[model samples]
Target: MKVKPLKDNILVKMIENEETSPNGIILTGAARGESNLAEVIETPEIFGEDQEILLRGETVMVTPHCGTEVKVDGETYRMVSYHDILAVFEK
Candidate 1:
């Protein structure tokens, strides 16, 4: 990826929604309805000094329509506001 998100913006790659669980439960993308869990690709250039709420390569639940979708080298990515990030998950 050659693009950088400025200020408090974060660049992320969408993670595929689970299709099935180990317990034989079927999980569909529609189950999420209006949110997407994505992996952060790049952290914002500015972190206000020692802020650690977000980091590169972290999986986080983000608002579905918070940012603009960008295409880079045939891959799709979203640049979202740092405040729009709802939750972080262990990779």
Candidate 2:
């Protein structure tokens, strides 16, 4: 099932990074640290007739450990407020 955020909320998928150890072992994001980086999956379509500042597919930096967790089709997503979005990465 597909999920859409309401109001100023945004749906995002966390971007995980993997690190290679000196012994050739791999470390996941969880081992290193929780990533604040996420990719925009969906944003509220309308907000007072003004276009949303954030667009889908844009990478964003959000406040750590914020937002509600959601699960859809076996994938995890975060529903965060627009205010929680610190910055957006330009393509």
lDDT of 1 by residue, 1-91 (tens): 5887888788898887667677878877676354488999988666776456577888899876778889999999888888888899975
TM-score of each: 0.74, 0.82
What lDDT does candidate 2 reach at residue 59? 98
CA lDDT of each prediction against the hidden true structure? 0.81, 0.86
Q: Give residue 44's lDDT in candidate 1 (0 to 100).
A: 61
So what's the TM-score on candidate 2?
0.82
Task: Give the runs in model 2 whose Cα sits over 4 Å from its true position.
Answer: 21-25, 28-30, 48-52
- Colliding residue pairs in candidate 2: none
Candidate 2 overall lDDT versus native: 0.86
Name the lDDT of candidate 1: 0.81
Q: Candidate 1: TM-score? A: 0.74
Model 2 per-residue lDDT at 78: 94
Using lDDT as the measure, which candidate wins?
Answer: 2
How close to the true structure is residue 27 of candidate 2, measured as C-alpha lDDT? 84
What stretches of model 1 exceed 4 Å from their correct place?
Answer: 20-35, 49-53
